[model samples]
Target: MSTEERPPKRPRNDYGSSDASGPPALQRSTDYWFDDGNIILQVESTQFRLAKSVLAMHSSVFRDMFSLPLPQDEPLVDGCPVVILCGDRSEDWTHLLAAVFPLQLFRTRNPTLDQLSAILRLSKKYDIPLPRSDCVRRLKCEFPTTLAEHDQLDTGWMHIEIPGDLSITQALVHLVNLAREVGLFSILPLLLYDIIIAAEPGENDHDNPNVLHHALRKLSTADEIACLRFHVRLMQPYHQTPLKWIESVPCVECTAAPKCSVKIDLLLGLALNAPNALIHEFLTQWDSHDDWSSKVCEKCLIVAKAVHETARQKFWDRLPSFFELPEWEELRKMDFE
Candidate 1:
């Protein structure tokens, strides 16, 4: 099988084996938690967020100094840090607030193995000590999934370990929404494109076609199509939603033909029901995009069109001395018409 087709999650290596009980209680005093093959430095509530910010800035600085282009597929590789320092009993809580502000202030340096070991030791020693739920809860958000149900969690990370044909794509779809939820655009380009958490903000109270038109144009190639699995594909109309029972689809004969006559959309291969916005965006974007190809493989026409050379190169020339791509400056003035 192609590398692209491998299962999304590899075997969980939560510190050599799935001993869900975790390291012996005394080992909890170890400053870090090693699980799922990553060493995380623990930080108390105040320190964890600060550390995450510091890490992000540090990563960005490294990116600029290296002058590397964004990874075409995944976000720039991020090293696992020792867990952020969630406090323990010996660590004084009253004075710790001062430290929290400082830690949350910026992305932090990667903690050493010793630091991580210390955090893990705390977790093992006492189930709850300093920092309280508020602090840990915030730190926990950094991770996509929580450690609550799992054996050993890289609590400040997002991860999925699933096996399937399109697990990566499925993960991407989920990640995109997560990114948008946090207001980050283009985490990593859809180079390997396993998912798209396509979104259009706000509800459609009036069902305006102009709103639809604009949404159609937002049909960037980045949107994920998991939505199609929940809503019936355009061709085979089914009443999956309340509106489906009342709202008739437009022009059934020519434009509305469906793909894969099966009414149940198993393509997602996921148990999730697609949200309304995601479902609509996928259908609109997929069906109407200039990139839409009419062939067996469903390749997009974007590669042929993105570099509208005559138009693009002209813009590329007039930009600030150090610039790339077609410059927006000239293109705005030249009315292609």
Candidate 2:
């Protein structure tokens, strides 16, 4: 299959230490509870003695698995079943257990990117709704599905907290992988957009040995070309004249319509030099404009507002095509049920 057509691969996890013939040696965890626990779940070399009921409540997968009668040859620790789970990390189990138990306020707070990522993967895999939904909701908050949501945000929304020792580029790279792993495709466009932005001069090398490089390596030649084209488009100046439509609109409030037009035109010209200049940036600068609003008539402001909204919408409509993604309508439906 083509690289773009292939499914994203899950990162190799630490597990399966005791897949051999005999029962694995028990190394019960001191951190996790052992008293009144009915099961010992082994992830990698670490063993966690946790309540079966607690796990079953959060996860339908655990519930269904526990419902099955234990095999005659199954291993046991203190009469409790010792289920050795493979292809997962002990840290992931810790995060999952932390989220399910009342001992920690996992659900009542925002997690670090690493914690959130762990919760997302484990919750989705184990069919746990609360953590999974919260993770999805958090991602959607940053990577909104609709143009309306995106419009409300500023350039400030592009900056996120870089967790751990990772640079901004590395953090974004991790997010992209996490989004794909958890089936949260809605976040892909925003993540990819930000990655390209962060890869600018003095940020980080695209060829660096990170998740971002690996992701790029997985793209097909066509998708890579599309990405390059999209980057070029993002860098290009928004050269369309904002005065084109607003100048022709009737200015009823003032007899000095020509003067009003000159003021509005000057405002737009100044906005083009603003950092990361785009139609939205131009509109925002114009709308909150302290100087120009005083100079222009009310009719001028009204017409300018209409022109700005139209220009921003047009830009939004073309964004997905730049990255070779589906249209906005189709993109919004991507990860939904």
Candidate 3:
């Protein structure tokens, strides 16, 4: 019998090979290509050379995977087994690895929103508890449940440096989407409120009714409808309670009732015309407006402040209801669970 010549045995030591039968040539990760690493993870067209021990130490999923025996035909690169990571973005892997091995010089700086989002997602996926817990803590600090924490917050609570091209509206929308995906419902009310206020139309918006804010357009239809509905319903309680002083005849002890009444009317007009009046914190003390204190009496100011405080607390208590969400306690419980 004539012996049939078999096809030449495929080479097993072809490093960086891109033959037709093999995977496409992968670009080595600029930040994660460790020369001595024992495992090669390929995400999309990018390859990250990393230590298996380091990955197994941090992630139980990786530890368990490494404990299993590999197939006889497993592929290798530079003698390290190649693991093809499917259904994950290379950008996310970059962020996760950066967090895992943060540079010493930038250790003090907070991660940008994009980095935080990626860490939160990948850490959860890999069951890396430390980074995931830290991310959640930072997120809770930014999107607090209590009104007191919200009032005390600085202009920018999260980032050390926001990208110049990314507006506050875009950031809020990104955060809202991330929060929804991560099941962080406790923070959704404040995030949604911020989105609504940031996307409120300007005076010239009426001239172009069809023009939508870019950030508002990004919102899911369900969220867009919920926010609009909440805004409409908010006006009634807002005017009747926190701004009820506007409709009052003035404090009975007013030294100049007529003049005080005129100032109140002016304020009422301003409130009615203000785009975010419904969501504005009525209890916010206006330090720069000395005219209000000089024009309006101490007794009237005190009364207005008291009414505003009570109404505002009640509003915060029911904030989740406006967005058709579970109560704050329930939402918080969901987070812990």
List the RMSD of every prediction in angstroms.
23.3, 9.3, 3.9
The C-alpha stretches of model 3 lying farther than 4 A from their native spots are 1-24, 203-214, 247-249, 273-278, 281-292
lDDT of 2 by residue, 1-337 (tens): 9989999764323344444665554456767957789998888767898888888888899999999998897656677888878998888878766666647544345567777788888887788998778667777887776667865676643323445577665676677777767777766676667666655543244355344344455455654566667656665555453334445433666667777767657655765554243422422434554664576667766765677577656765666676778876776576631
Q: Which order, best to worst by TM-score?
A: 3, 2, 1
lDDT of model 2, residue 191: 64
TM-scores, all candidates, are 0.19, 0.71, 0.85
Q: What do the candidate models score in CA lDDT, each in turn? A: 0.30, 0.66, 0.75
The candidate maximizing lDDT is 3
lDDT of 1 by residue, 1-337 (tens): 7889977863333323445464321222222222332223333322121243333333443234235443445221134433333345334422232322343656344332223223333322332223223232322333212112222334223322233453333444444453333222323222111122222324543455243233323333334232332122322322332213111221123232244212113422221343434333221222243322332121112321222222223322321122112233342233111
Candidate 2 has a TM-score of 0.71
Worst 10 residues of 3 by lDDT: 280-289
**In model 2, what are the clashing residue pairs, if there are any?**
none
Select the stronger candidate by lDDT from 1 and 3: 3
Q: Model 2 scores what on Cα lDDT?
A: 0.66
Backbone clash total, candidate 1: 54
| Regions of candidate 1 where Cα sits further than 4 Å from its true position | 1-169, 187-337
